[model samples]
Target: MNILILGSGGREHCLAWKLSQSKKINNIFAIPGNAGIAQIAECTALPINKDNFPSILEFIKNNNIDFTIVGPEAPLVEGITDYLEGNGHAVFGPSKDAAKIEGSKVFTKKFAVRNNIPGAKAYFFKKNDYEKAKEFIEGLDAASYPWVIKADGLASGKGVLICNSRHELLEALKDFFIENLFGKSGEEIIIEEFIEGFELSIMCICDGKRIIPMEPAQDYKRIFDNDKGKNTGGMGSFSPLPFVDNVLQKKILERIIFPTFESLKKEGIIYKGILYGGIIIKDNEPYLLEYNCRFGDPETQVVLPRLDNDLLELLVNAGTGNLGSTELAWSAKKCVCVVIASKGYPETFSKGDIIYGIKDYSNKSDTLVFHAGTSMDKGNIVTNGGRVLNIVSQDKTFNGAIEKNYNKIKNINFDGMQYRNDIARKVAEK
Candidate 1:
């Protein structure tokens, strides 16, 4: 079948790679795909947003595209799925209303409270209520020093900040309200009690009724190693969490996943596609951190490599609302993905620096390079965004996979290139 993918990032490239391997696929196309995706699929220069919906629809019809997979949350939140479905096109994503779970923090918080979903204690405030928010924070005990301040709307994963003192908290609030650092996304803010724990990523495929879980993955969000520095899209990720036993998994599915789906159902929203929970495991118990309406970025880079089933078929089933009792298969091997980003990422950084050593490992069986922010410049591939590329390796052991990634990364370089050195380090050591 002819398939079309939306967005221009590593996630889209990975999706194209997996689907291209499916024998059932006839032709693959991507809208605004990056350099690596262009090598395997037909890449077009169409933007994936509400303003280009008509043009996107025209392209789909002209190319007789049978299915479309959305890779980013922006278009989904802007109602692309609703529009495409309204036009009778099959799409693998949630409707705009369902996407509000990710688009609005206040909405998700209220939904969690109403459904008794376990999460951090949070207080919401509008931009005009800075004084009330300040008063609320000042009334809190000093023990809650490190509080999480979040923008209610999306800010490319940089909206959440951890304030360790009253001075820091007030500055963050000023950045949100007075400085307008996050634009309209910061119009509403959430001051949440910071839960101390390691974060986990759980993605489930839903068909408006039933849900099927994928293997759990752990991703590093901070820009530097050891989880320090400000957050970026993602720094690295690994799959098949060594610490998550069946019991903990069951609790997450029961307490967080089930209630989330059922609650959405009660609200008359039929969610079809990926329901990704950003969960925090504290004291062996799971707490909901946030939700991403689609697959996680670097998490997808690692998770998809371990999946043994035909991804195209699964997505088709989910999109068509016929995902009946489907159980996923997975490879026993471990997978690791490390992101190669431009220096000073998650902030202002230069672009168009020439990259090297990618083609040397292009044909390696154990390693795969998925491009995120790259473009063809006079026959040379150059950096085009902050998070540029993903180097993924799969092996029978975590140590083997982790070693393979680092070894290959040494040969790849560009001006102002930066990456975390400790991806999956603890697991490999163990």
Candidate 2:
């Protein structure tokens, strides 16, 4: 079957890589794919924007694309799945209605409360209610100093901020509501009670009813090491968290994942495709941090490598809502992915710097260099976006996998290249 994937990041590149391993797949194509994805699949200049829906449909018909997978949230929020499904195309994504769980933080926060889902307590504020929001924030107890201000809409994972003092909180609120830093995404804001705990990411395949959870992953969100800098898309990730054993896993599935689906079902939304739960584990209990409608970026770079199943068939089955008796198997090995970004990432940074050593390093066994933001520039690969490449490595042990990746990362370099040195140190040490 010919497969078409949307988006141009590392997650889509990893999806393209995993899907290519399936015998059922004939040819794979990515819309506006990056330099690394072009090595494995046919990269087309086809735009996947909502306005170009007709063009995508035409390409689907002409290319005999048997299935399509969406790798980003923007097109999905614009009703890509609804549009594609209405036109008799099977798509691996949630409908716009279901995608609102990610698109609108205010909607999802209220829905979670109404459904009794376990998550952080949040107070939603509109753009015009800055005073009321300020009053509410000021009234909070002293322990609530560190508040989380989140833009109700998507901001490429940079919309959430953790403030340590009332001064910082007010500044963040000003940035969102007063200064309009996030634009439409900040039109509505959510001030959530900050909770301190290590974060966990769970990606599951859902067919409206049943949810088949994949390996657990932990992603570093901050742009700098030691989690000290502002949040970026993602800095690095590792799969099969050592701390999440069978007991904690069962607790999460029962208390979080299963109930979340049941609540969505009660709302009459039939969710199809990936459902990502960002959780914070405190005192051995998992609390829902947030949700992503699709796969996580660096998380996918690590998690997909551990999958021992035919990803193509599974996604197709999930899209059709038939995923009957299809159990996914995963490798016992551990995986790690360290994102290589342009200097001053998650902010203004120079691009078009020539990158080298990727081709030579990726030739190693159990190692892959998935491109996130790279383009071919005059016969040389150059930095094209904030996060440029994911150096992925797999091994029987997590530490070994991390070491292998770092060893390989040493050889890869570009102008203003930056990456976290402690990708899996916390988990590996524990």
Candidate 3:
């Protein structure tokens, strides 16, 4: 079958890589794919947006693509699935209505409240509610030091900010309202009481009726090690969390995942794609941090490697509402993905620096390199975006995987390269 994957990031590259391995697949394609994806799939340079939907559809039709997998939230939030499906194309993603679970933080927060889904206590504010928001923040107790301020709309995973003090919160509000840093995306905002806990990314395939949960993955969002500094898309990720035993897994599935699917159903929304829950576990209780309509980056890099099932079949089944009879299989081995970014990522940095060492490890059985922000410059791969590449390694133990990635990463380098040193250090130490 001919398949088309949308977006240009590590997640899309990982999807292309996984789908390319399926013997049933006749051809694989990516829209605005990066260097790594181009190696294995036909990379179509088309902008993935609402205005470009027609062009994308034309390409799909021209290529006789059987299935299209969405790899990012932007196009999904913009209603690409609805458009494609309207034109008689098969797509593996939620409709625009269901994508509100990620598109609008305010919408998700209210939906959670209506569904009794556990989450952070939040205060919603409009762009015009600047003074009102400030007044509310000023009256808050000093004890609640770290508040999470988020833009209602998508901001490429950079919309959420952790303000540790009243002063910082006000500044963040200014950035949203006054400075218009996020523009229309920040027209509405959510300020929530910070939930203290470790974050887990749970990605489940929902076929409008049944939900098939993948192995849990833990990702480091902060650009610096020790969970410090600004948040990038994701710095690194590891699968099969050591902390998530059977009890915790059951709790997550029962309390968070099930209710989420039911809530979407209650809204008359038949979600048919990946329902990614950004969950925070506090005292062994799962709180819904957020919901991503599609798969999680870096998390996908690790999770897909641990998947023993054919990715193409799973996605096709989910898209066609045939997942009720589907069961997932996972490898016993652990996987780790360490992201290599530009020196000054999550902000601004240079690009077009040649990358090396990929050829040496690309053929290895235990290692795989998935490109994110990369491009071909004069026949040499160079940096193109902030989160550039994902260095993935698999092993029987987390320690082995972590060590393998770090050791192999030494060979691949570009100017102004930066990555987290402690991806799964805590788990490995245990």
For each candidate in turn, the TM-score is: 0.97, 0.96, 0.97
In model 1, how many backbone clashes occur? 0
**Candidates, ranked, lDDT:** 1, 3, 2
Ten residues in a row with the worst lDDT in model 2?
Answer: 358-367
- Residue 99 lDDT, candidate 2, scale 0-100: 93
Clashing pairs in 3: none
Q: Per-residue CA lDDT of candidate 3, range 139-254, in tens?
A: 98889789999999998888999899999999999999999999999999999989888889899998888898999999998889898988778899998898899998998889
lDDT accuracy of residue 153 in candidate 1: 95
The per-prediction tally of clashing pairs is 0, 0, 0
User: Judged by lDDT, which candidate is best?
Assistant: 1
TM-score of 3: 0.97
Q: Please give the lDDT score for candidate 1.
A: 0.92
Candidate 3: where is the Cα deviation over 4 Å?
360-364
Per-residue lDDT tens digits of candidate 1, residues 1-430? Answer: 9999998999999999999888799999999998899888899998787999999999999999999999999999999999999999999999999999999999999899889999999899999998998898788788778999999998988899999988899899999999999999999999999998988999999989888889999998889899898878899999989889999999999999988999899999898889999999899999999999998999998999889889999999999998888889999999999999997787876689999988444533888899999988998898999999999999999999999999989999899999999999889846
* Preferred candidate (lDDT higher): 2 or 3: 3
Of 1 and 3, the candidate ahead on TM-score is 1
